[model samples]
Target chain A: MQAWDISFSKLKAGYGSHVVLTDVTAALPAGAVSVILGGSGCGKSTLLRQIIGLSKPLSGEVRVAGRDICTLPPAEFRRVRRRMGVLFQDGALLGALTLAQNVALPLTEHLNLPAEAVRAEAVRILGMVGLSDFADFYPNELSGGMRKRAGLARAIIAQPRILLCDEPTSGLDPITAARMDDLLLSMHRRFPEMTIVSVSHDLASLNRIADYVLVLRDGACVFAGTQDALRASDDPYLVRFLNRDGAGDDAAAGECAAPAVQASLDRWFAS
Target chain B: MPQRNADDISRASPPVKVLRLLGRPALRALNAMGSVTLFMLDGLRHIFTTRRILGRTVRQIYVIGYQSLFVILLIGLFCGMVLGLQGYYTLVRFGSVGMLGSAVSLTMIRELGPVLTAIMLTGRAGSSMTAEIGVMRITDQIDALDVMDINSVAYLVSPRIVAALLSFPMLTAIFDVTGIFGGYLTGVCMLDINEGAYLYRIVSSVTMTDVAGGFLKALVFGLLVTTVCCHQGYKAHLRRDSVGPEAVGSATTSAVVISCVLILAADYVLTSILL
Candidate 1:
């Protein structure tokens, strides 16, 4: 359980012929829950992809534990990736495999563990996610919240040093989202050395689980500090986002006055 | 404003518009070919590089090969019966009814057996493979594999390719045997042909070379159909607005059409060489 910090320096990422994020630089502290906050299409997911080595940056470097992963060869990159786990937005569980089998996939693929051990570990992790009873069910048979929980169990089963979650609370009810936030915080507490980077639009979940916050706007790191610092700041985008005023629309004004700031603050803290 | 639009249309002209329309797809096809070639090469490399995929390849053989046995057998029987009926009537008119055995056996071994087997597989197994992989792509399962440090091509595509390559020739052999028996049922049992002449004529006319050539053709057709299907499925995300069943449906249709065309084209080329 060694701590490893993730650093991005001048990282530019995008698809072919389109640039999403540019000149982004940040160092996610070791052994902390770092929440990346941004509206949809703000390149939060894109940056996550770069960090996971699923896609290379358009320019600059992504360093994991002081090693530049951007220049690593395929074999070396895979070695680096083996130390990390990712929970995708849709769970991305193999529909053909049952919940237990899905959780055991990384273990079965990467390790030569005995079948009994694989099954035992898979069941143990499923229990941690409160899904031990649903071990035999396929992903499609599970509810949306169950699927996300199963995905989380799979992500952490390998004991990865870094856990990347993409919108884990998305598409869930408020109660379910709160439970998800609790599970994430519990996971962080359990593996005190693991760095958890979650990209989310859920302000409530962010306030509950985040030890540090990174706010992205139009593919730039507009703010990077603690939740308390973020709340005390007078930044317009942060204020607008914190208030949940027209958060879905990209054209929403950052310069608009925060009319119900006190009520929003109360609601945020209450959740 | 209407006149200005008309002027703009005229400025482009019919020939230029036609060229633009034709050029885009032509370039797209070329690009697809290049990408598919690279994917196939990667798959080939992984076939030897990874030994773990052997079990998956065997499982795939059961799904892609063993499951298709009944349909392939039915098609072979009906096809041979039709060939026997038609050849018998034509040869009878020319007073060469004794040659019916040679005609049916030659046709089955050299051409129809390999070609029809490929077409059936393209429709049955090839389309299914495309749809399965397409679903995996759109659902982000493939991306999940990538992030897990698994080579998606090695884990997914290579096993399928290996299974298809092994199964096709065996399926073609089954088609040949059943087809010959089907011709026997029609030619001797129904057409009043001499039984000794029928069996003897086939024995003398069809050589080891012909059987070998037929097997080679089947092997090639299997590679083509599987490669095309896998390529289509792997590249499903590249298609604009394609998702879920729409992506799967399009990939399945495209795999069948493209595999059938390539089978026919390769048939001509192989015929020239083998014959």
Candidate 2:
């Protein structure tokens, strides 16, 4: 398996004039787990959306496996997407399909495998996520944490070169969150060549899994470095965030500051 | 002072307030219409562009057509029975009870069959389609499809549109046939009307042109219902305030209401052209 790197070059993206991110230039190194961190509305998910080509940046480019996906035509873009997998925040599994069927979807859609083979492959992936027994269950039947794991199974079932996860542990108990982080790490070790980019506000999970960290503030990349570098940084925002400070004594003030404060507070309570 | 008072007066005027109140919904409705048209066009384009959707389209036909068969038949039978009873009483007053067969058959073939079938579909299949897709939208399942490199509109929408288009005429024909039979049972057997005259009048009065017109109306109504429902569902997530069950409910209600209105309006226009 070969590794694929995702690079954003001056990416600008948003919804119809309300720019969520601007000039976000960064790279997730090949085969590494890169975690994007931000307060609410800081454009972490926007960056993820751009990287996956779900929505094109207003300008600039997103390069995956050295191809600029922003410029690819629809068919070519789909080909590019086939090499990537995304796990949405709420699983986003098809409610009508059982868990196994949901996991088998990409295989059935993209490959001409026999029905038995697709089912076998789906079951294999479900085992990996520890949901082998729940393969027949619907997404609605699963617990929130189980849904996330099932979503991960679906994401990696196609053996994607890159995996994108949006808030993989946003709504979970501490134990479940830790389990999710462990699962992510184990998956990374199992598929050493698959680059994983996760958008999350979970500090503990980030510390546990992130090899590289990118922090956004006010739609701009305020920090991008290794986890060690982030830990050592004296940047007030980073320090305040890492320390779980709700007071803005060292943080910036005004409109952007309030949301950041509220975000940190929300995370504090969430954790 | 005078200018400011005049501005206030104009702003508070009854006509201006009425215009303001009406303008918002008018604009919203126009925007909705534009969105639905574009969605329908996109689905139509995909109908030609994609060939692998046959399986999904067939499944949709099962859900939209086969599942709704019983309700459509029941509605058709009741409608026909009512028409027969009413026509018998009205025509008997003028000693023209024999024309009851012509009236029932013609009504079933030309007007009631397509219109009533569509109304039933709007309440049944159309609302369900809207709610299903709306739930998908709210749950981010559609976005999940997008990330999976699937064209959400083509994959989720085109099949329903195609299924409805193919199924509506079939359902309408079923409705008309059942309705005519129901009329016969009421008029000939129950009311003791002449059986020979009843069957003969139906055969003579109903023409291919009337049948074709009914089918044409069903086709248009099917397009309108499916397009409106799917469009409503697809756009539910775009609304700023709607979420979860509210979004699905709103989409379903709006799909049924808007499609019903459009069906009736289109019926008038199509009837004028065909008749």
The RMSD of every model to the true structure, in order and in angstroms, is: 7.6, 6.5
lDDT of 2 by residue, B33-54 (tens): 7888899999988887764689
Report the TM-score of candidate 2, chain B only: 0.92
| Cα distance off (Å), candidate 1, residue B63 | 1.4
Which CAPRI level is candidate 2?
medium
What's the CA error at residue A64 for candidate 2, in Å? 2.5
Highest TM-score among the candidates is held by which one? 1
Tell me the tens digit of each residue's lDDT in model 1 across A1-271: 5798898888899987688997788888999999999999999999999988878888988999999998988789888898898999989999989999999988888788898999999999999999999999999999999999999999999888999999999999999999999999999989999999999999999989999999988888888889999999899889999998765665565465376986788789999
lDDT of 1 by residue, B117-205 (tens): 99999998999899888899988899988877778999889999899989999999999888988888899999989999999999999
How much is the lDDT of residue A82 in candidate 1? 88
- Candidate 1 scores a chain A TM-score of 0.90
